[model samples]
Target: MSANAEDKLVIMNEEELKRKQREKLKKLQATGGNPRPARTLFLFNLKNPFRKACTSIVEWKTFKIIILLTIFANCIALAVFLPMPEEDSNNTNINLESLEYIFLIIFTLECFLKIVAYGLVFHEGAYLRNCWNILDFVIVFMGLFTFALDTINKIAGVPPPAPAVAARVTSQPDPAVRRKRRPIPLIPSVREADSEV
Candidate 1:
């Protein structure tokens, strides 16, 4: 084809692609999806310096990796804490509760950053619009709620509740009593063997 014809063909293709995208977006919106436009709508003024900074920070790959690693570390800490004996947990130099609080603070900060970068729930591409984001939002609030309760308890001089495992263990029969119970024999007893003979 001639150069002019090629140029016209390319232009037509570009227009066709744009049309397809528009149609797809319309279908998505019709089905209750929040299809965001090329130009995003921010909760606050787009020109605000803090919001702009937050948007950049939230979009950075390193920031996402750091959050993922923090989650992994928190999971490892929980795993270590769960199987530990209640007695050993108290004597350990590393306080798992304090580690949990630190993890919660990091997650809460990440949540706030995303909220500033993307609008909370009103705008398209808002923080709470995605299902995963909604889960994170609920978890952060739950952490804050627990933190508040812990603080109140400390101020009121109320003791923390015992763990269910600790309570169950405490209620079990004494070790000596448990040891006295005879095991059921899989083989015939000597008296049974003599009678058989």
Candidate 2:
């Protein structure tokens, strides 16, 4: 084709691209600038108040730094409590457990906010799209599962299983172990174990 014709075609394409970009920017601004993603499993309308709030919060550097600090705090709490000798008072253990729950709740909120800001798995830039975010999602859900299991056992008045028993239950099942499993009591005979025994 002639050079003049090619130049005209190129100019038209560039103008069209620029116009599309401008339209996108206007739509974004109309929807609170940082609206929820499209094609989400749970719908958050463009005008959802939380959609913008969460997007802004998730994108904020200070919010990320705060989450990082909380994770570090959680690690320190685990380090301090996990290695405590058996002789440590029940109060100390309870305090540590409570602190752990608080940390878990904070992490859960972070996850929820991110899922709101980005979509879950369907949309571009979704939560599960990032490797780090997938890892975070798994960790948070596992922590939540553990919390629910503990709460259920407590409500059922089932004594916490022995460490070895708990380990066996979680690991690959052994036929021999299953055969020897005893029925868990609805109410433990003793509220506190005889640590001396």
Q: For all candidates, what are the clash counts?
A: 0, 0
Q: TM-score per candidate, in order?
A: 0.62, 0.62
Q: How good is model 2 by TM-score?
A: 0.62
Evaluated against the true structure, the overall lDDT of model 1 is: 0.80
The stretch of ten residues in a row with the least summed lDDT in candidate 2 is 81-90
- Give me the runs in candidate 1 sitting further than 4 Å from their true place: 1-43, 83-88, 91-94, 163-197
Report lDDT (CA) for all predictions.
Answer: 0.80, 0.81
Residue 75, model 2: Cα distance from true site in angstroms: 1.5
**With candidate 2 superimposed using the best TM-score fit, by how many Å does residue 145's alpha carbon deviate from the native?**
0.5
Highest-scoring model, lDDT: 2
- Please write out the lDDT profile of model 1 over residues 76-164, one tens digit for every residue: 88777744445345633368878888999999999998887787877667888899999988999999999999999999999887686
